[model samples]
Target: MVILGIETSCDETSAAVIADGRVTANLIYTQQMHATYGGVIPELSSRAHLLKIAPLVRTSLSKAGIELKDVHVVAATAGPGLIGSLIVGYTFAQGLALSLGKPFIPVNHIEGHIYSGFLMNPAPEFPALILVVSGGHTLLLNVRSHTSYQILGTTADDAAGEAFDKVAKLMNLGYPGGPAIQKSAEKAVRKNISFPIADVKGDYNFSYSGLKTSVLRYIQKNFPDGVIAPEEQSEIAYGFQESAVGALIAKTELALRQGSYRSISVAGGVAANGRLRDRLADLSAKYQVPLVVPAFEFCTDNGAMIAARAKALIESGIPDYGIQEPFPSFKSVFADAPLVKRS
Candidate 1:
C-alpha cells in the first residue's frame, strides 16, 4: 500500500510517498522567510505552508511515479507544533482521505523522529533506546516494540537545538544555527574556556537552559567589549558545541547503563550534528552495542520519515481515524488505536 504523508508542523512544508516501509519520493520546501527575522514567524509560516502544500504533494507523487489516487492511506503530523501549521496539513489530509475513502492516520512529531531510525536501519531489534534532539524538543525514549514506547528523559527548559540557534544569533551567525555553528567550530582551535554542563541528578532528565545562560555569561566576561573577533568566535562556538554534546553523551551513557536495552538510536534535527553523531558512535563502541543514526536527510523534519512511520503503523494493524483531530500535545503509542490486520 502506498501512504501519502504530509508534514507542515513548522517552517518546513513537506510531503512524501512511501510504499510498504520504503520512501519512494520525498519533497521538502523550507521556508526561508524567517531567516531575516532570525526566528520563525507563525503567521508567515502558516501562510507559506498554505501556498506550498498542494503543489509539494503533487510533486512528491510525480517524483514517485504515482498519482494521488493510488495512495491507499493518508498520514500527517497531527500536533505538538505550530497550531496554524498543523491545521494546514491536517485539513489537507482530512479532505484528501474523505474524497478518496482512504484511512487518515495521525502521527506524533516526536514519534515520527523515533521511527526515523527504522527507515534508515530497517531491522533494529526491539527494546532500543532513542534520543530525539531538535530545535523544540530533547527527549530520550525507550522503545520495547513497534507500538510500545516509554519516555525516559526530556528537556525541562530550552531544547539543545534551540540553544544552538540562540548562541548562533548571539554570535551574529545566520539562522538555523546547528549547521552554521558546526561549520565554524570545525575551523576553531580548542580553547581552555570552560562551559558548564548541566548535570541534573536523575536517571535521564535533562536541562539545557543553564548551559545556555553559561554561554551568555562566558561571552560577556571574555568579550566585554561586545562582538567577538572571528578567531575568538570560532573558539567560543567550538567550546559550546563540546559542552552540549558532552552533556547529551553523558546522559545517554547513563541511560544505557540503567535500561536493559543494548541498541541506541538518535534522531531529530540536532542528531544531524556531526560531532554529536561521532560522540554517540564512540559511546556505542564503548558499550559494545549497535547504534542507529539515520541519514542526514532523515535527521531533519521531512515527509519521508512520516510516510515511513505511517506504513509501519498500518502494517502493524493500527487502524486509521476517518476524521482528523489536531492533537496539539498528544502522547501515546500507535497501538492506542484499534488494530485491523488486512489480508
Candidate 2:
C-alpha cells in the first residue's frame, strides 16, 4: 500500500511517501525563521506550516512518482506539537483521506520518532529500550512489541535538545544549537568542567534544568566579565556538550539495567548529535546490547516515521478517522487507549 505522511509537529514542514515499509520519497522544509529568534515561535511556526504543507506534499508525491489518487492511506502527526502546526497537517490529512476514501491515521509525534528506528535498522528485536531526546521531549520507553510501549521515564524539566539550544545561544553559537555546538566542540579541548547530574534514584527520569543553570554559573565564575574569549568559548562549548552527553548516557545505562532490555534504540532530533550517538554506541558495546540509531535525516522531525506508524495501525485494524482534533500536548494525544491491542 502506498501511504502519504504529513508532519508539521514542529518547525519542520515535511511529507513522505512509503510503500510496503519502504520510503519512496521524503521531503522536508525546515523553517529558517526560527534561527534568528533562538527558538521557535508557535504562531510563526503555524503560519509557516500553512504556507509550506501543500507544496511539500506535492513535491514528495512528485518526487516519488506517485499521484494523490494512487495513495492508499493518509497519515499525519496529530499531536505532541504546536496546536496550529498540528491542525494544518491533521486537517489536510483528514480532507485528503475523505476525498480519496482512504484510511486517515493519526500518529503521535513521539511514537513516530520511536518508529524511526525501524526505518533505519530493519528487523529490530522486541522488548527493546528506546530513548527519545528532542527539543520538547525526553522520554525513555520500553517497547514490548510493535504496538505495545510503556513509558519508563521522562524529563521533568528541560529536554536534552532544549539544553543544547539554550547553551549554544548563551555561547553565541548559531541557531539550532546541536550541530553548531557539535562542530565547535570538535575543535576545542575540554577542561573536564564537571557538571552535576540529577540524582533521581531508582527512576530513569531525567532533569536538565539544573544542569543548564549549572552551566550558566560556571560561565559566570570563569568569565567574570561576562565575555569569553574565542578559545574559551570553544572550550566551554566542549565541556557543556561532554557533561550533557555524560548525563544522558548515565540515565540510559540506568534505564537499561532497570528494565533489563538487551536492545537499545535512540531517536529524535537530539539523537543526531555525533557526540551523543558515539557515546551511546560505545556504552551499548560495553553493556553487550544491540544499539540502533537512525540516520540524521530520520532522527529529526520527518514524515517517513509518521507514514510507517500509520501503515502499522491500518494493518493492525485500528479504526480510521474522518477527522481528529489537533492535540497541543503529549498527554492529550496518548491519553486514549492503545489503538491496537497489545500482544
Worst 10 residues of 2 by lDDT: 334-343
Residues 1-343 of candidate 2: C-alpha lDDT, one tens digit per residue: 9999999998999999998778999999999999999999999998999999998999999999998899998999988888888999999988989999987888888888988888874545788888899999998888887668888788888998999999998887878989988888887865655678776777888888988898899888887787877777778778888888887888888877666776889999999999998998898888898998898889989999999878767766664532257788877755553454322
Regions of model 1 farther than 4 Å from truth: 321-324, 330-343
Candidate 1 local lDDT, 110-217, one digit each (tens): 778877788874545678888999998898888887667777788888899999999998888889999988988887876756688998786688888998898899
Please list all clashing residue pairs in model 1, or write none if there are none. none
- Runs with alpha carbons beyond 4 Å of true place in candidate 2: 319-323, 337-343
RMSD for all candidates, in order, please. Answer: 3.2, 1.9
Position 76, candidate 1: lDDT:
91
TM-scores for every candidate against the unseen true structure: 0.94, 0.95
The lDDT per prediction is 0.83, 0.85
What is the Cα-based lDDT of residue 3 in candidate 1?
87
Q: Which residue pairs collide, candidate 2?
A: none
